[model samples]
Target chain A: MRWKCTVAYDGTQFEGWQSQPGGNTIQDFIEARLAVMFERRVVIHGSGRTDSGVHAREQVFHFDADWSHGPDKLIRALRTGYPDSIQVYKAEEVDEDFHARFSVVKKRYTYQFFEGFADPFETRYFWSTGNRRMDVERMNTAGKLLSGKNDFSAFTANPGEERDDDPVKDLSLLRAERIGPRVILAAEADGFLYRMVRSLAGCLFDVGIGKLEPEDVLRIRDSRERKNLVLTAPAEGLFLDRVWY
Target chain B: MRWKCTVAYDGTQFEGWQSQPGGNTIQDFIEARLAVMFERRVVIHGSGRTDSGVHAREQVFHFDADWSHGPDKLIRALRTGYPDSIQVYKAEEVDEDFHARFSVVKKRYTYQFFEGFADPFETRYFWSTGNRRMDVERMNTAGKLLSGKNDFSAFTANPGEERDDDPVKDLSLLRAERIGPRVILAAEADGFLYRMVRSLAGCLFDVGIGKLEPEDVLRIRDSRERKNLVLTAPAEGLFLDRVWY
Candidate 1:
C-alpha cells in the first residue's frame, strides 16, 4: 500500500532532507525507522528537499508498506519510532498511481524576518534585520514584480544540484505581511529552483532596507544571472510551510 | 549610575537566571559582558530567578555602571556583547533608590502547552500534551479558582530555596486561553512561591484532562499542603513573561 503522510520537522540538526552517506539527514532517519518497522529497507519519497537549518510545517511524503493494520497503525508506528524533531501527523492510503513529488500541484514557502534588533527568544526561528527598519510596502511591491511565470535564474543557486532544472516557473503568490515586529514573506509556486525562494526573499529584503529599489527586482530577473543577486537569505529562516495537491 | 535593563533569553541552553559556581547562567553572561565593557567586575541584580529550561520574555535587572556613553550606548554594547540566546533590549539610568528585586510590584508568567501531538518545529518552545485533547474551559475554570489572595502552599515546591517565604499571595490573573492547538496559561501575582506557576498549571492540566474537577483547585488551595497538588509542569513550558513595577 502507498501511504501519503504529512510530516513536520526542525531541520537545524539534520543535513537537509536527502540522505548522503554518513550525514544526519531527515530522509536517513525516516528511512531507517521505516526499515526497523518493516524489518527491511523501505524508501520514502519526499515532496522536495529542504536545505540544512530550514524547517517544515507540512512536508508531504509517500512510502509503500504492507502493514496489515493499515495507515492508522503505520502513523502510530512512525510517530513512536521517530524522534521529537520529526513527526508524521497525518497519513492515509493513497491511489497506487499517486506520487508525492510528481503529484504536487503547488508548494508554499515562508521566510520570516524580525525587524530591528533580534529578539533573544526568537533568534532560532527568525532572521534578524540587524536593527534596521524594513519598508514592508517596498518589499511587497518588489515581491509583486516577481510573481507569475518568469525566468527566475537570478534567484537560483546551484547548491551541488544540477542547474539544468527549468528556470521558468509560475509563482502564484510572492508577498510580504508584517505581524507586529516580524515580517513574513510567503511564496507559492508551481516549483522552486534550488535556493530560489531564499534568493527572492533576500532581494526583497534589500528593497525593504533601501539597499535596492523596487524596480531592481525586474532588472535582476531579466538579467538571468545568479551572480547579480544581493543575498540568498539564510536557511534558518525558511520553512516549507505547505504542499497543495 | 544605576541602570535598569529589560532582558530576554532562551533558557534551553543555560542553567537558569541565577549564577552558580562554574555554571552557565544568564547573570554570569551578562556580568562577564559588562566586566569586559567596564574593565572591572560588575554585579547585576535580577528581579528574580528562573529555573533551568525556563524562558524569560522580559526579565528586569539593575546594575551600577559609570560608563560615559550612557544607556543607549550601553544597550548597543550589550547587544553586541551577548550571545544570540541572551539580550538586553532597553536600558535606562535609574534613581539610586531603585532596585530591580525589591521594587517589583508584580510579575506575570506564562506556561504554554501544545494540545495533541508535538509539532517538530515548536518542540523547543512548547510542551506537548502527549496527543491528548484539552478542555480549555475546564482549565480556565480551574485557573480562576486559584486566583485572588490565598495561601498557595498546595502549589509550592521546595527547590533548595528557603521555604520561609510567605505562602499567602494575591494572584491577579490565572487564565487559560487557547490559540489554535496551543493553550497558554497566564498567571499574574504579587510574587510567586517556588515552582508555584508550574504547580498551578499542572493541576489545571489535570482538570483539563477530566482527571480532576475544577472545584478541586479550591480544595487543594484550602488544604495548604504541597502533597495535595497533582504535578509540577516541566520548566521548559514556563516563562517569566513580564515584570511590573
Candidate 2:
C-alpha cells in the first residue's frame, strides 16, 4: 500500500530534505521515526528538494508500506515522534502506482524580503535588505516576461548539469507584489532547474534596485547563457508553498 | 541629558531585562554598546523586568549621557551595533525628572497559547497546548473578576518580596479571546507583582479546562494568600505588550 502525506516544517534546524550521512536532514529524521514505528528500516520519499533554511507551507510526500493500524493512528504516532519543527498535517492511502515527485504537475515557490529595517521577531523568516529602497513596480513589470515555456539556461546554475537534464521548462506564473515594507515574489512552473528560483529572484532584485532595466529580463532569457545573470538570492527567504497533481 | 528609548526584543537569547553579574541580560548588552559609543561607562534604567525567554513589543528605558552626536545619529549607531534580536525603535531627549520606571502610569501584558495542533513557524512565540480544549468564554467571564484594586497576594508569588512592597494593585483589564486555534490573554495594570500575570493566567487556564469554577477565582482573591494559587505559566509565552506614561 502507498500513502500520501502533507507536511509543513520550519527548515532552519534541518540541513534540507534529502537524507545524508550527517543524519541532520528532514528525510533522515522522518525515516528514522518511521523505522522505529514499523520495527524495520522504512524509507520515505519527498516530492522535491529544498535548500537549507528554506521553509514550507504545504509539501507532499509518499511511502509504500504495510501496517496493522489506520491513517489516524499513523499520523498521531508520527506527530508524537517527530520534532516540533516538523509537522505531518495529513496522511491517507493512495494507489500503489502513485509517486510523490513524478505525479506532480505544478509547484509554486514564494520568496519574502523586507526593506528599511528588519523587525526582531520577523528576521528569521524574511531577508533583511538593510536600508536600500527597491522599486517593486518595476520588478513586477519585469516578472511578466518570465511566463511561458522557455529554456531557462541563463537562470539555472549551470547549463552543463548532467547530459540528459532539460533546460526548457513550462513556467506558468511569475509575479511580484509589495505588502507594506515587505516584498513577496512568487513563481509557478511544471519544473525548475538547480537553484533556478533563487537565480531569477536575484535578477529581479537587480531590476528593483535600478541596476538592470525591465527589458533586460527578456534579453537575458533569450541569451541562453548562464553568464547572462548573477547573484543567487539567499535560501532563508524562500518557501515551497504548494504542489498540484 | 536624559534620553528615553522605546525597545523591543525577542528574549529567547537573554537572561532577562535587568543587568546581572553574569552580564547576559538585555540591559548589559545595551549598556555595553552605549559605553563604546559614549567613550564612558553607561547604565540604563528599564521600565520593568522580564524573565528569561520572555519577549517584549514596546519596553521603555531611560539613560543619562552626553555626547557630541545628536539623537538621530545615536539611534542609528545603536541599531547598527545591536544584534538582530534587539531593536531600539524610538529615542528622544526627555526632562531630567522623567524616569522609565517611576514615571509610568500603566503597563499592559499579553500571554499567548494555542490549542489543537501547533504551527511549525509559531513554536517560538506561542505555547503549544496539545489536545486540550479551553473554554475561552468561561475564561473571559473569570477574567472580569480580576479587575479593580485588590491585594493580588493570591495571584503573586509571595508578600515577603520586600520590606515595603505592596501587594495591592489597580488592574484595569484582564481579557481573553480566541483567534482560530490561538488563545490570547491580555492584562493591563498600574503595577504588577512578581509573576502576577503568569499566576493569573494559570488560574484562568484551570477555569478554561473546567477544572475550577468561575466563582472559585473570587474565593481565591478574597483569601489574600499566595497558597491559594500556585501555578505559574512559562515565561516563553509571556510578552510585555505596551507601556503608557
Q: lDDT value for candidate 1?
A: 0.88
List pairs with backbone clashes in candidate 2.
none
Kindly list the per-residue Cα lDDT of model 1 for residues A38-141, writing each as its tens digit: 89999989999998889899999998888788777777888876578888878998989999988999999999998875676567678988768789999999
| lDDT of model 2 at position A151 | 95
Error (Å) of candidate 2 at residue A244 is: 1.4
Chain B global fold similarity (TM-score) for predicted model 1 against the true chain B: 0.96
DockQ of all models, two decimals each: 0.66, 0.69
Error of 1 at B77 (Å): 1.3
Q: Model 2: residues >4 Å from true position, as ranges?
A: A158-164, B20-23, B158-164, B228-230
Clashing pairs in 1: none
lDDT digits (tens) for residues A1-245 of candidate 2: 88898889999878888898999888888889888887898888788888778888888999888866888887888887777888888898999888998898999999887887667778777887877778988988888877899999889875344635578989998888899999999999998887889888888988999998989998998888887455788887888999998
- Most lDDT-accurate candidate: 1
Best candidate according to DockQ:
2
- Candidate 2, which CAPRI tier? medium
lDDT for residue B44 in candidate 1, whole number 0-100: 96
How accurate locally, in lDDT, is each candidate? 0.88, 0.86
